[model samples]
Target chain A: MGRQYEIPIGAQHISLLEPLHFKFTTENEKIVATEANVYYVHRGIEQACCSKFKFRQVSFVVGRVCGLCSISHTTAYSQVAEKLLKIEIPLRAKYLRMLVIELDRIHSHLLCLSHVAENSGFEALFMKTMQYREFSMELLEAVCGNRIQYDFSIVGGVARDLKPQVAQSILERLKKFIPQLDELMDIYKNNWTLSLKNKGAGAITKEDAMRLNVVGPFARAAGLAIDVRNETEDLLPWKQVGFEMITETSGDVYARNMVRLRELYVSIRIIENIINGLPESALITETKAFPDGEATVRLEAPRGELFYYAKGNKTQILERLKIKAPTFSNVAAMAEAFTGNEYGSAPAIIASYDPCLSCTAR
Target chain B: MNKVMTSIENLKKDIGDFYKPELHHFMVMNAVEVGDQIEVQWFFSDYAHPCDTTCFYTLVRPETEIPSIKDIVASAWVAEAELVDLMNIKVENTQKGFVLEPDFESGPLRKKK
Candidate 1:
């Protein structure tokens, strides 16, 4: 402990989208330990869900948990509610849900990659990634009528159906976007400056990740083959839509970026498959049942596994609603990643985790 | 989903026996208040087959201090601290004020008046 001191990084920082406070204890410019405070954005959504909102209305309310992964929140909440209601959605509705989820995954990954680039001091790459990310946003707007916080998912099924022309347009846009993604992947992989900055800055080994209960791209990047989409087949037919889990063994910032980029391709492929094999059915089912039991739902959000627990007592209002966001689970791993790294690279390491404080604090 | 009801004293032993890091990934630890008791659920899953979930729940008095599983599953500290802040459930060897600011009171997830 020779001349040890503490440096604080944002409750509001340029690299962070939401408020997250980190106090890094450093000695000779290397981090020895870290303390994180992520409660700045807590809005009591869990209590509000049980006390304020009805079962049918909770899906839309939970969608406000995080703007980027709002689809994941809505999907997780709807699945839990649907389980309690015992509603089996139609094939067409399932396909539409999968389509929008894949779209959301693509945009969310691109946003994260761009943020990582910006934090790593590659401003040009950040701008380029943002430019390519616009295509996914435009496609989402065309389908869901809004860029962010799209309330396309309802309890029994989806709120809107995708038109034939909209599907065709999505296919065309994805076709045009693949080449751009390939070029971006090339740059991400081969850029010497980026590789130097991110290659091993926040590396966490497989054992540490497992012990820390890491999820999603971070876990997958560390060689963990855990994906909720691969596990939960009853919710959606991800296999039928050509969903494949992408993994990297490095468990570093570069590895995380590679995993996200590759998953973007996987999401695009799933969207294309859904468009090609889309079935025709009712957008939403007519169900007059009320929830009277408890159900737990877990889904793979862009960052990681988003979990929701809902309990009802044969009434319109729920008894309790519990949400454990991926970032909430990854908090320990995030703190661990800060250790054994230089203080200067903290922003890039934090950005590589792609934390959603609003989701975590909710 | 498999549900196992255990007592507060046997929670650590039961969870220690059930949680195999290679086979099960710790999902989350959740606590809900029921009348005079607080129902705590520890969720774990087989990542290879995620549909298979093992849930271990224990009901305790609101003031009872639950043993922390941070020694077994290191990441559980976050969840343990969260329960302390949100549900007002006391847990041993865990920090408070994770989701609530230091100046604010705890138990935001509890029933309101």
Candidate 2:
């Protein structure tokens, strides 16, 4: 090693959104080793869910874990809680849950792509992407009556019915977004400047991804055919609503961006199908019984597979609640993938990984 | 989900026999405090099969030294470290000041009488 140096970033940094720290050991601008700390924002939510919140109300509490994938947390908790209660929600409720989830995924992916552009020193592209992303946020606000913490998903089912006018507006907006998405796809796929910075940066192989138990787009970009949506058709009817797995082979930042962009097309199709084939049924399955057994639920959050485990004693409070976020699984791969990249490219690479520390540290 | 109970000694053999990275994806290592002992469960998902989950667990005291499975499963370190900090799980060579503050003497997850 020629003139090795230890460089520390975050716990607080401009490029990072959450309090995640990484100490990179670099030699001549190439990262040789990386140590990461992701617990800066850990807030005992699991313990609170077990002790403070009742089993029925824990869904809302878990929803606060991550702003981006709030619905994922709530929906996962609801599913696990449903299993514990041994109650089956209506088909309409399940489809609505899938609806909000796909909407959330669209915005979350766009936000990540924008950050990648921003961190890659392409501020103009970042601005352009964010401008395009506004539609999803507005749509989410219209759908759930709130922008961030949707509070849309409850224990048995969704909170509100999808009014026809709102559904019509959603279709109109989605129709408008397709052209914009296509434009973005073209830019991200063909732009020479972006390709130069992201084509080979932060690449991980399929074998390494599988070894590290990587999930979501990061693993999908590396050619790993792993998705909770693909596996769990019992909980949510993803396939009935036209769910398709999107993958890219390169496993680099560029490929990741491509995967996210293309997945938006899939999301759009799912949303349309959900609206067109919108089932007519009760929004929730009311349960007077308390949760009474151990249950595990796996959901495909925007980032990756979000796992929730809960145990109940036929009482109001849950005996135990454990949440394993997507970023937790990606931590090893994140550190390993940084080994051969330049120090300056760290921000873009980190953004591309889409490290969700709030979810991880919780 | 199929759950099997294993001892500390047989844990390695059980994991070795059941786990193949290509076939089964290791999901998470979860620990829940049962009455007095801690119930540590290792969860895995079938990559080839549809919605099949295998869970292997061991009941041990908080002070018992748990073997690190990082060598067998590369991604075990993170969850192993989390259990160390949150549940006072005695996994050898794993750091504790993760998911909790460094000065905490005991895990917060341990129920108080």
Candidate 3:
């Protein structure tokens, strides 16, 4: 038997973007086992949303769960809250929500791609990706008036209506972005340097992904074909906004990068469709009703499926609130995929997973 | 979207019969307190149809040892460990602090008495 050594990385590490710790047991250069401790950032947000916040205020509170997927969290909460009240939002509000979500996906996927590039020792490509990502952040600022916590979604509907100028600007910027996205797709798909560091380094099989019940790009990359957007039509009308499922068969770091890269094309398409056919109506639904029953929502966050469950008893405060971030579901598989891989490529693999720990730990 | 109320004893067979990885994707395990009991629900989605959902739930006392569905669904381990750590629920082969530190005084979501 080869000598085994246990190596621990981060509750804080240079390569780890989140406050998560992983302990890997290695024999020579290959990992044999892995353990993860990822709750260092847990802030009891769920409890706060239930006890400290009113039904109307909980939408903004849940928005803080993860900066990257702030829109997803708030939108899901609003949808569940809408369900509890038994009222539907305006078609205009639904279209605006879809617009911001696709924009958020663009920046989020690029950020993940940039981190993956940086972790793989390709600093130049990382820089290039980040430069391309800035446009989405600026667009978000114009639309929602904030960069991190858009607060775009409120209880009954969206907080702001899309101005014609802003809509036109969005289309213009996205038109310019298409060529940039195509450029990124070519580099991610054909780049020899990235392939060496990522191609087969960290891999999980389709059966393993299904067994683990993985979601989002992690599941899609493994050929699972699971996306909340592809499933539910009762909420935001994802199909009408041109939402499409993107998947890759490899289930490795390389395949994950490709999935994120290719999905940006779909995101761009959704944004264009939303802008081109946005309906005109009231922004907020103005419900005087209190949430009186149980409701659950499943949303496609940048990383994976974000689930929210809430219960109310005709009171201002919710009875219970649960936020299940995508990373939490993948935590088991995160550990499982590390086994039998060279420890040197761990950083890139971790980045490819695109974890949002604050969302999970909340 | 349909929800069924079941118990810990039937958790395995109920979920085992319902879950086929190729056909269904297990979603999540959710918990909420109602009166003196905790209501826990298991969620699953059909892959082919995508819109068809099956949820199996149970209401139990706070101390009940809920059976883990890890054997039936591999990813149930995280959900099981999370319920133990945050909701203070008891489940087989799962430990607390999977999401919270072990020394924390109480489960974060446990209702204050």
Candidate 4:
């Protein structure tokens, strides 16, 4: 047997946006096993939602779970609370919700792509991707008044209405973004350095992916064909909004990037449809009733499926609030990916998973 | 959603019969603290029809040892570990401090009187 050594890569690292610690046991240059510690940023939001916040206020609080996919957290929590209240929001509200979520998905995926580039040692590509990513950020700030952690979603409906001028500006921005996204996709597909570094690295077979219960773009990359947007038609008219599930077969870092790049186009299309067919109605419903039962909600966040469970008792505070973030489910798969790979490729592999440790810890 | 209530003893058999990798995708394993017992639910869904969920739930005392589903679903280890640190529920084969620091003694998610 070859001599084995251990390398510890960060509870803090240059490549990670959020804190996650990994201890890899390497035989020579290849990783034989990996152990991940992901709860460095837990803030006890679940306990706070049940003990401190009211049913209505919990939506805004849950949005702080992760800045990248705050909308997913709030949307999932609100849907559960809405279920307990037995209220169907206005059609306009649903369209508005869909619009912002698609916007969030675009920005999140772009950030992950940029980080992948940076970790792959392509600094210029990283800068270019980040430069284009700002457009989505600007659009989000224009619509929600804040770039990150935007408190745009409320229990019964949205907090603010999308004015005509704002919708026009968003459409114009999206049109300009399409060609740039196309160029980025071309660069990612044709770049030799990126493909060599990532093409077959950290790959998981379809059977292993299913055994590990992987979700989100990572699973889809491995030919899992599991997307909550395609499944949950009753929650939102994703079909009417031009939603499509993009999948790739290889399940490597490169395939994962390809999946994200294609999904950006899908998200852009969904946003355009929402803006075109936006209905006119009240932003919120008039309901003062308290929550009195339990409900569960699932939504497709950028990373994967986000799950929320809420229990209420006609009181100001909730009885329990459970949030199972996408990264939480993908942790095992992340560790599995680390095994049977070279230690040099660790950063890129972890980045390819696009883990949000804050979301997992919460 | 289809719900199947089973005891800790019958969990392995029930899950073995219900879970088919080609048919059902394991979604999540969730634990909630009820009045005197903890409710643990194992959720699985079909990829073709996402709304169709098959849930296996069992209620046990906080001190009762629950069986681990890692043999059935490998990804369940993460959630099972979290339950040990958060809800203080004992599972058959899970390590502590997966989330909470080793120096910390109390489960953050436990209800305080």
Candidate 5:
């Protein structure tokens, strides 16, 4: 009297952004089970890296771990290397790192929201969000010399300091995004169609969410109250600045959207704080020599927590670099969250978690 | 405690025989180089599996030989292989049995190379 069903989302499809196979076992339109077949896009990134590159050079290399999270990758990597070397970067350098990383978070979250809008057939919102994103992208290019791959963080410090004029100009640009983000959030909240589509979709209980160790905005939306920045005292310059961790008890698509929108403002405030109270000191180290040791470093990326372990043998080449990116752990939670969601709402629900397959596959 | 060591030692003792052999205690681990020797410290807890730290006692093996802990830990096998691949350190008797083959011409991080 028992029967089972299996349907495969094959890897060969043009719409599939990365090479991954999902075997969805379903009963009618309800997903009963999901089996993920990854490793298709596994490029042996961990296998390929070794002592051949200097700590500074490795920043650019690991920055490719995910375009959406390049800042997080480089920041974590640099922090680990700096810890190993026992070097305290100038206070200005730390603030600069905070500034750039938070900006990256803003761009990443907006991009995710825009993609969510696009998936939900809200074309106008998508176009408008993209137009707003251009300003942030341009700001990144103006400051760090590249749009996506910002080769900013060096082992001891940043490659360059934010010039006063550049900082002022960037502040003006950030001000322009505030009203726009507010308008977008208002639309998401008030739009009947969007609300009906997103509300109560892919909801998870707070207990279940905590038991699964779900992180980033998803867990917060469910009231887990975990943020790498807030959890670790050593992690932030929080006392000098102010921002609240946004939470929503619903834990649905709507909750996730609100948390992310609030995070955009939080990121902007953090950047503003860094610029205003920036310590006057050197940004880059005078010596390029690295120390012989190993260190584990963790940082709050736009998505969630990222960790890196590095070893150096007192040479230009690093002894080893092993990283654990957020997408790796978040994907499992995504699969779990996907259950009971309508098939038609799958793309938007998936986008709600902001899947960066490159981060996962890399 | 002695009980922890006895349990770990029961698995393997040779420094080069187990495959990515790790013991999780629910905390974190970092490898620190002190003078001429390497010291790997485990920051562990009694809870939180998969994501938390485990107390790992390992030996460098030329081939895979680490015993199965699937009953205890869910994703230890793949995680071990990842560590071996990234660090070029070996663990013996793993699920894969053999680590990635050393077909690449150069060892980028090893000083002897």
Candidate 6:
């Protein structure tokens, strides 16, 4: 119905609270192309890591890289330094690490689901998601002492040990969340407007997804069955704690939503299993320091694959520290996926990826 | 073979045949007064693949003759240029002098004397 139009959205807006801007070039209401302005608030975390902190101090610094995936950043840093130091963490420590990471996944995904419901004008559904999210958040606060940025990881092992009472409390809360999530899932699946808005709105083929190398929920939505946690078996010891990697062949906004929701259940199950067989040992491993060498570690963050590379010269200070976050890698694909989609669905489609721009920028 | 031996052997095999040919690609590589210079490691990536970590040593100061790896890895182009600009590492036959920002003299990472 139209030839050309310019739709300019902000680095900040009412619905999309994060500092990210998108300018859509459109024909009628269907977006033909899009462009983005990134690094507007680039805190220069990498540069700061290289210059400001000594080796030990960098862990605490990078943990503040992204609030939502603080564990992922810290875990990646710790794991890389562990390789450099040539020290193997204790068995109990490894399981605890997995438990905390699964908890982070649950914590992040619930917030994303609620945001989606809120954006779609489903007030009741949004409230339910928020209510369910509180249980996870409360458990996190009880375990790690802070709900938002849990500085629970140190160089060799975890910062805090899980007391029996705390573990039991978390277990009970997770038990309460399972049936509530299932009920919410039924409502989302049946909602006509929600399905219509999400389904096939931002579809990308499997081949394109592979070429773009989308990871996490976005990759799963494209039917790629790759999960770093499953691949790294020594990290997770439990047997019956099962999680089927959820995927949707449609590769649309709806598929992404489905993948995230299903993953929520898997994360809760993983936590339950960890508590059932909590290991016995000291939480912190003996630390020497990072040696004169370079180490790189890859971990599956809630968004996608996170890579942390560190170079140490056997000194207290690190020579180089580089972080490659998921959003940076997926930026191109996001632009491609949004093309030809209706401009009205732009906010919802972008929100479907549940982007944490802080993670991307840092 | 034993577990340790097998891991060592796997690593040796992973280094591949080009270990000798590609040895001369590093320059101005060493830790600055960080105890002893135990080893210098190299993180190499081919035109199409991800970077693979390798090692260079003090005994054989890797050939500093060749240009930096800007052609092979696109991302490292800016990084290497910045390194040269800041650290004053004289990379021979290097094209395009500065990467971070020209006229920005004095290194930010160096310890104040």
Query: In model 1, which regions exceed 4 Å deviation?
Result: none
Candidate with top DockQ is 2
lDDT of 3 by residue, A308-341 (tens): 7888899999888888889988988999999889
Give the alpha carbon lDDT tens digit for every residue of A1-362 in model 4: 68999999997788777799999999998999999888898799999998888888999999999999998888888888889898998889888888999999999999999998989888999999999999999999989999998898889988988988989999999999999999999999999999877899889888888888889999999988888999887777788899888989999999999999999999999999899888788888868899987777889999999988777889889988889899888888898887888988989998999999889988
TM-score of each: 0.98, 0.99, 0.98, 0.98, 0.81, 0.78
Supply candidate 3's per-residue lDDT for B65: 88
DockQ (CA atoms), all models: 0.81, 0.82, 0.79, 0.76, 0.12, 0.07
Candidate 1 residue-wise lDDT, A244-338, digit = tens: 98999989999999999999989988999999999988888779999978899888899999888888888999988889899998999999988
Better of 4 and 5 by lDDT: 4
For model 6 the local lDDT of residue A107 reads: 74
Listed for every candidate in order, the interface RMSD values in angstroms are 1.2, 0.9, 1.3, 1.3, 7.9, 9.7
Clash pairs, model 3 backbone: none
For residues B57-92, write the lDDT of model 5, one tens digit per residue. 433233333444433333334444433443344444
Cα displacement (Å) at residue B34, model 3: 1.5
CAPRI classification of candidate 4: medium
**What shift in Å separates residue A108 of candidate 6 from its native position after superposition?**
0.6
Q: Candidate 6: which docking quality band?
A: incorrect
Question: What does candidate 2's lDDT look like per residue over A131-183, in tens digits?
Answer: 99999999899999999999888999899999999999999999999999999
Model 6 lDDT tens row, A163-225: 899988888787777788888888777789788777788888876665555667887888865
Model 4: residue B2 alpha-carbon error in angstroms: 2.9
Pairs in clash, predicted candidate 4 = none
Q: Distance from true position, residue A298, model 5, in Å?
A: 0.4
Error of 3 at B60 (Å): 1.3
- The lDDT of model 6 is 0.66
Quote the positional error of residue A76 for candidate 2 in Å: 0.4
lDDT, residue A127, candidate 5? 90
List the candidate 4 regions with Cα displacement exceeding 4 Å.
none
TM-score of chain B of 4: 0.91
